[model samples]
Target: MKKWFLISTIVLLMIINTNPASAISNAPIHWGFTKGKNEQQAEAGKAYDELLRKHHAFYKGDPNKKVLYLTFDNGYENGYTPKVLDVLKKEKVPAIFFVTGHYLTSEPKLVQRMVNEGHLIGNHSWSHPDLTQVSNEKLKEELKKVKDETARITKQKEMHYLRPPRGILSERTMQLANEEGYTHVLWSLAFKDWLVDQQKGWKYSYDNIMAQVHPGAVLLLHTVSKDNADALEKVIKDLKARGYTFKRIDKFK
Candidate 1:
């Protein structure tokens, strides 16, 4: 009986020890704080520069008229994502999730749930690295990594939107992403919402988010915020009441 108990314990330990770190491959992006400057890199990538101009022209400087797009960046899953999803589900609003490679691999079910529920999934790079700092080759690889992983796991066509890590953009990063079939995305408003170490309560963040909302606002939220989860549904309801309808990014020129 003692031997059987030890064997069972060992088996359980083994199961826990060998689980995948990401739903995908093991890479350095999995183990580092994604830090960097991207606007400088765009100057270097002529193609990236063109992409910026293209999208700017596409919108014709009128993105804030009777439409709103809500995008969440998924660098790491929060304990709150499930609840956030619950709120979104309850409200019947479809939003976009710009996911990193780790999010694709660590939360495969969430990826599937995003697609199954008709929300768009855009690429946020493989490891959330600042694209402008890496070489063009590396940037392309990063772009492909997230796009491929998310599509492969979810069995969906790769979406065309790509949000830069830390909102950093470069000519090179933009060019590479565009060449690879993505339009660079940046938010009009984002605060210190990504730091999982700090616990700013929802009431504070909610007021901040509400204060920032405008016509055709593309609000940025992170998956790792308790305040975000708490504020999400309430914000959605409050925004809807105030005549803001949520939609995926509808213009990509």
Candidate 2:
């Protein structure tokens, strides 16, 4: 009986190991990249490129195209989104806003305005938890809540893009997200601009952006930063002058 029990236990372990989900690493990866300069594209290195590509994710667009994709994280409103929206309206720039459940509930009108004004809304998870640490069911729940709430509020039936909460992800999370029809939208350009209390100035935001500007760059900005709102208009005008056309995420190649 003891010998048979040992054999059964070994077979169970083998079965668990062979499971597809179990085979992928759940080790969390905090997304980072080497900054691009002189108008060259930023490098996410080979491993990140491979992992992202395999999951149909996007960090940047075609390297040869002087096209930019602008995205904002809306975890919570800080009374500056209106200014940002106004700038986008004036300059006719397109952007995607990744919103959390809190944002959806707390600022439904703003979210509706986003859709009404031809901007795309993306899922930033329900509670903004580190997705790599959540179980498959929990992850699904988190995503579902945001998607459903977004649909209810904006009447936008499809939510295809997802920016992992806190920029944390893993192979397991990516695979799960892909299975849910969410294409992970990572960024190729970002800075320490999310800190609300540490905002330097509008020029600070502008300078960092100008320095990192590149072909096919995807920029991640926080709506909570007053600097971003203040500098947005000039940034758009200047980037346009530099011959960079801002494109919607859906139009990205």
For model 1 the TM-score comes to 0.74
Compared with the true structure, all predictions reach lDDT values of 0.69, 0.95
Which parts of model 1 have CA positions greater than 4 angstroms off?
1-51, 55-64, 251-253
Off by over 4 Å in 2: 1-18
* Model 2, global lDDT: 0.95
Question: Evaluated with lDDT, which candidate comes out highest?
Answer: 2
Give lDDT: candidate 2, residue 86: 91
Q: Summarize candidate 2's per-residue lDDT along 113-195 as a digit string, tens digits.
A: 99988899999999999998889999999999999999999968899999999999999999999999999999999999999
Q: What is the lDDT of residue 203 in candidate 1?
A: 86
Candidate 2 RMSD to the real structure = 2.4
Supply candidate 1's per-residue lDDT for 140. 81
Assess every candidate by TM-score: 0.74, 0.94
